[model samples]
Target: MSIQIGDTIPEVTLKHIHDGVRVIDTPTVFSGKNVVMFAVPGAFTPTCSEHHLPGFVARFDDFRSRGVDVVCIAVNDPFVLQAWGESVGVPPGLQMLADGNADFVRALGLEMDASAYGMGTRARRFALYAEDGVVRHLFVEAPGEFKVSSADNVLAHLD
Candidate 1:
């Protein structure tokens, strides 16, 4: 089953590419924080690169002022995620996380099989507002759609 509001986000490990590959624990990072996490189909895809991730980067301040940490997740490797972050100039408070093994996305029941597109396993586009470790709101976009998971939509709910 997909994660729902009021559920505690499961503990999963994510990678952050920095001075080297760093392993980040999901529960440790999200616990005790008001978090806004959005997932994309893949790094550098047209829709994800052009609109989805950029929306969050552009609205970084909007989410910060409200005391929320915004993050982006993709099924790509950490190296690719790091390159994408640098290429896009991801601002502070907007994190770029790599679910390289698709473990976390699969746990949420949000995994997408994109082998037809030669993308292998990927994450469906989605976003969530979580308080501490419990999900307060969830938005999973329909396949090929990009409405609910956009930054504007997530920020509007925070207002």
Candidate 2:
């Protein structure tokens, strides 16, 4: 079954780009913290490039003002996310993590098959509000659609 409210954030090792590839320990990342995490199908895609990640970047401090950590994840490698972050000018502290192998996305039951597009498995567009590792809210979009998974929508759940 998919993750739900009250479910602990799953444990998975993800990657982040700093000077180089860095390990992101999922469990420790969420431990003792309130976190807002969003995922995209891939990095550098049109909608995600124009809307999703930028929304989070714009609202990064707002989420932090409310005492939450903001994170973005995609199926692309850490290198790709690194370039995307720099291109978008994502402010420091909003982590952009790589679920390159789809392990964490699949663990959340949020993986999608993009093999038809020659993209292999990717993460669906989704967002979640979590505290101390337990999910408080989740917004998962339908395939190829953008609705409740946007930063504005996820921020609404914070209220």
lDDT of 1 by residue, 1-159 (tens): 989999999999999976899999998779999999999999989999999999999998989989999889999999998899888889855789999999999999899999999999999999999999899989999999999999999999987
Residue 84, model 1: Cα distance from true site in angstroms: 0.5
- The CA lDDT of each predicted structure is 0.92, 0.92
Clashes of each: 0, 0
Per-model TM-score versus the true fold = 0.98, 0.97
Q: Lowest lDDT 10-mer window, candidate 1? A: 86-95
The TM-score that candidate 1 achieves is 0.98
Q: What is the lDDT of residue 74 in candidate 1?
A: 95
Name model 2 segments beyond 4 Å from true: none
Which lDDT value does model 1 have at 52? 94
For model 1, the stretches where C-alpha displacement exceeds 4 angstroms are none
For candidate 2, write residues 1-159 as lDDT tens digits. 778888988899999977888997898789999999999998889999999999999988889999999999999999999999999999989899999999999999989999999999999899999999999999999888998999999998789
- Deviation (Å) of 112 in candidate 1: 0.8
Give the 10-residue window scoring lowest on summed lDDT in candidate 2.
17-26
